[model samples]
Structures are given as C-alpha cells and as structure tokens.
Target: MPRTNRNGADTKFRAFSDQTRLRILHLLRAGELCVNDLVEIINVPQPTASRHLAYLRRSELVITRKKGSWTYYALAPAANAFHKTLLECLGQCFDEVPEIQKDARRASKLKQQGGCCPR
Candidate 1:
C-alpha cells in the first residue's frame, strides 16, 4: 500500500476506522492511561491493545513514557487538535440523534461506576 500523506483526510479517517483504536483514543483524551487500562476498557487482549498503541505512537497521535514497569500513553497535543475538532462535531451529531444520546449517557454512567456492561 502507498504511504498516506501525513496531513491527508484519508490518513485521519483510516486512524479512526478501528473501533478499538477509536475507543482508546477517546479514553486517552480524558487522561494519560496505561496499556492495561486501555486493555480493560477496550476489552481486548494486552497484545491487541499494545498493537494499536504502537500504531498510534507511530502516527504521532499518542506519546508514551515509561514509569517503572508501566508505560503510560497520552494524546499528543499537536495530534489531538484535529481529533478534538472531529469529536466535537460528532458530539453535535450525537446530540441531534436521540438514540445516540441515550447510549452515550448509559456508557458514561458505566464508565463512572466502574462497570463494563457486556457489549
């Protein structure tokens, strides 16, 4: 496959195509989190979470720092500008869609309460 242009919409859309990856990015927006946290929240194996993290790191969307045995990941400030804008637009669409609004509320409650409602 040809390499995607760094500033192209195709690259951005490709990055957000994977549901797991998108969830990981969303969670990272809230705060820096370790691979384990992403694995838990994304309900994926550690290796899978790590793979996505690696891809995001390579794309410059996420940055990581080693702390003891753990490596924590966070959204890179420069990378997040586009994502933040895109998510804000999506947020508006979700607000306009009642079903999406309900789902978002339910998911937020689950996250706040430390529960993973089986997908």
Candidate 2:
C-alpha cells in the first residue's frame, strides 16, 4: 500500500515533467475548459489533447465535470501540503513561460469568442 501511494505521487510529478502537460495545467489555472477548447487553445489535435488530459487524470491532478454533452477539466483540489505547493508552484512558475503565455492568450481569445465548442 505504501508503495502504491508512492507510485501515485511519482505519477503526479511525472505529469508535471511534460511540456504539453504543463501547458495544459497552465491553462486550467484559468478555469475549467472542455477538451475542444483545450485542443483549440493549445493548437493540438483532439487525440493529442485528450491524451494529455488522460495523463493528468491518471495522476489525479485533474478532475472532470460533465455539463450536458461537454466535459470540463479543472485542477483537482489540493490533497495535501505537497499537492498544494506543487499547484502553487505551477501557477507561479509557468505563468511566465513563453509557450504557456501563448496558450493563455489563445485561451483568452477562445473564451471571449464564447468558446469554440458548440452547445
């Protein structure tokens, strides 16, 4: 059981180690976003975006909420001191990264346009 928990933590940290996943996390900092919005903002194919989201879900770093036909993803609530600090660090550290910045801009535009996915 101890080993299982440790592996879970390892998976969480590993999720942060990917550039695409990190960009996805950075975007989630804004609020919950549907997969379509994520694909549009990150300029990735649906499969690629969904793959990253699945990784985050496996790591327990994100939670999903279904709203009608669209599912939205958001950062999971901090589970412990470590998780809290990691999320805080993610928000502070990646806010300035060029790629993340570009993602944020695109996300903002998408939101302003009332989202890319149809209701």
Candidate 3:
C-alpha cells in the first residue's frame, strides 16, 4: 500500500503536490525534454530545474534516459495516463476556461520553438 509517512512514495507524492512540479508536468505533457530545456523554458536556474525534475523522477511522473553525457526526461507511461485523466477532469470542471485555452496556445508555441524554451 502507499505509505502515509515520510517514506519514498509519500515524499514523491509531496513533490508532485507542488505548483512548480505541476507546471513542470504540464510542460512535459506535450512531450519529453531535458533539464536544460526545462530551465530555458521555465526561465529558472539549472539547480531549480534539477530540483523539480528530481522530484518528478522520484514520483515516477518523469523518466530519465541517458544519451551520452546528457540525460533526457519524459513523462513516464504511467504519468501519461494520469495526465490524460487530469485533462479530462479539467475539461469536466469548466465549459469555457480561457486559461486552459491560453495554456494550449503557449504549449503550441513551445512546440513550434522546438521545445528549446522561450524564456
């Protein structure tokens, strides 16, 4: 069962429970990326990006693969299902949320920019 104490799973849940991590998840919703990509896109420092990513990894929300000297992170397959469910819930919550529309636009722009980040 999932733990209720300060165990690994609980700690990971706490990590994903943060706004920053959620934003990172949202960004990763469209596709996979690296820490540098996140840093540039989110306009945060390398350490900040690393912290959020580490949390996501611990939560199994993100998966990392090594490519030579670099590590690329993407939403784990498990995370994809959860993300889909989240979008469905959000869709149910609002008939016309401008914020969601705006976010979609931004995400589109990010994708067009090669996900290198526009920050």
Candidate 4:
C-alpha cells in the first residue's frame, strides 16, 4: 500500500509556483473552461495546457468534468480550511497583477467571440 502524505502545503505551493499554472488559475477564477479555451486564451499548445492542468489536478487545486470529447476544469470547491483560505488569498493577490489581468481580458474576449466551446 502506498502512503498518503498528510502535509499538502508543499504540493499546493508547488502548484502555484509556475507562471502557466498561475495563468490557468487566474483564467479559471472567472469560471470553468474547456481545455481548448485555455489553450486558445493562453496561446499555448493543447498539450502544454493539458500538462499544467494535470499538475493543478494532482495538487487538488482544481476539479474536472468531461463533456463528450472536451474536458472542463474549474477551481476545486474548498476541500478544507487551509485550501479555502489559500484560494481566497490567491484570488486577491493575483487579481491585481498586470499579466493576470491581461489574461483575464483575453479570456473574456475569447468567450465573447465564441472562439471555442461556448458557455
């Protein structure tokens, strides 16, 4: 049997350490989005987006749903006290960053244009 690590602070911190992951989390702050939408908005390749998303999933920072061939991801509902507060802090801190703001604008425009899977 494999041992489950009790301390997830390191895992959560690692999840927030990458620029791509941070961008993804900022994008997801608006709402759930498909992998294609993330790829388009972030201007990265499909595999790149998937790879970062996988990292987020492993960190238990995001949740997923599959519709047909598309997979959608959103911030995971607060799993516990620590994650809840951390997510709240992340939202507040990233909301003011210029790069994150730009990414949100791009994502908003893409959604408005129906660039990918429509909401």
Candidate 5:
C-alpha cells in the first residue's frame, strides 16, 4: 500500500474515525498532556491511550515532546488552511458531547492538581 500523505484529509479522517481518538483530540485542544493524564482523563488503559496517540501522530494531528521519562502530547499546529479549519471545527464540534465534556472536566482538575507528570 502507498503511504498516506500526512497532510491529506484521508489520513486525518481515518485517524479521527475512532471515538477514542476523537476524545483524545478534543481533550488535547486545551494544551499539552502526558500519557498518564490521558489514561486518567479518558478512563482508558495506558496501551489503548498510547495506541490512539500513535495514530494521531501518524495522522500528523498531534505532536510530542519529552520531559524526563514522560512524553507530552498537544495538537499539532495547522500545517495548512485545511488543517487549520479542521482543528477549528474540532473545537466547535464537541462542546455538547457529554463524554468529552467529562474528560475535559477531569483534565481541568488534573491540571489544577499539577497533572500526573512533572512539567
């Protein structure tokens, strides 16, 4: 199979197709988070959270960095107008989603408590 274009909508849409991936993306709209934070906020297993995050990384929708032994993730900055619009839409589309809203609340509280990893 041919490699999907990182900038192509097909790759991104495929990544976004999963409900877990969407929840992760929605939570990331706020700021950077650690894998542990995502596991806690999204209430998923660590491997499951890592799997979705890897998909997002392949889709080029999220970026990562390291601080000590922890990896942090954040929504990647838009690389084009299409990506810009998609990210904008992502923010607006999920406000009324109860599951994501609950994730957001938990994420907020986690942040206030200094998160699951050191900054």
Candidate 6:
C-alpha cells in the first residue's frame, strides 16, 4: 500500500469508512465511468458523488482520465502486493451487501440501455 508517505494503510482503510465511498468503489469495480453514471446508479446528487470520488482519488484508490468534457474514473492498479490484495477484496467483501448488489444491477442495466449519462 505504498502510494506515498503522506497516506499510509490507515488512510486506505478510512477510505472505506464511508458507505458512499464504498458504494462508489464497488460500482467502479466493473470499469471506468463518468461521475453522472455513478450519481444515477447510486441515486446521489452530482456533488455528493463527486465528493466521494475526490476522496477516493486522494486516497490513491482510484485514477481518472479526461475524455473531452467528461472525467472518467476507475480503480487504480495497486501500488504493491498488499494494495493489490486490498483492491481485489473489495468485490468479495461486499458480495452479499444489498445496497452494493442493487448498485451493480442498476449499473448493468444502464450499460445495457446505452447509458443515459451522456458522457
């Protein structure tokens, strides 16, 4: 988990402390997405979704790419073996979580329907 000395493993764990952040990360497990995609799937306001994404970015748990006017985010490659394991655990850890499951299903449907995110 050696992203930088500024934040240690504790910060990474803290990134999971918020349910919104957890939901965002779990949804991102599938692939990169625009913020609006998350906002729609999670039923959160755009600002709220962006805030959580910013938190994850600061934690180095995710990375971003700019496509024209939109910003897309995805799980970053782990900085080390432990970090790799932690990222892998995200999907398994929340497997039975009702909220997480609902998010995933909605995300799938969004893709199937060609996504209304306009990204």
| Per-candidate clashes, comma-separated | 0, 0, 0, 0, 0, 0
Q: Which wins on TM-score, candidate 2 or candidate 3?
A: 2
On lDDT, the leading prediction is 5
| Candidate 4, 31-105: lDDT as tens digits | 899988998888899999999999899888889998887788999988889988878888888888888888888
lDDT string for model 5 (1-119, tens) is 99867769998888778999999999999999989999999899999999999989988999999987889999999999989988998889878999988998899899999998888
- Of the two candidates 3 and 4, the one with more favorable TM-score, higher being better, is 4
Query: For all the candidates, what are their Cα RMSDs to the real structure?
Result: 5.6, 2.1, 5.1, 2.5, 1.4, 3.1
- Top TM-score hit: 5
Per-residue lDDT for 48-90 in model 2, tens only?
9999999898888999998788899999998888888889999
The TM-score that candidate 3 achieves is 0.64
Mark the regions of model 1 whose C-alpha exceeds 4 Å error after superposition: 79-84, 87-119
- TM-score, one value per model: 0.66, 0.91, 0.64, 0.90, 0.93, 0.91
Model 3 has a clash total of 0
Tens-place lDDT per residue, model 1, 29-81, is: 56677776665565679899999998887766788888777788887666456
The sequence of per-residue lDDT tens digits that candidate 6 reaches over residues 24-118 is 98888899989989988999999999999998999899999997788999998999887888888897889799999899899999999877555
TM-score of 5: 0.93
For model 2, the stretches where C-alpha displacement exceeds 4 angstroms are 1-3
| TM accuracy, model 6 | 0.91
> Which pairs clash in the backbone of model 5?
none
The true-versus-predicted C-alpha distance at residue 16 of model 2, in Å, is 0.3
Candidate 4 Cα outliers beyond 4 Å, as residue runs: 1-7
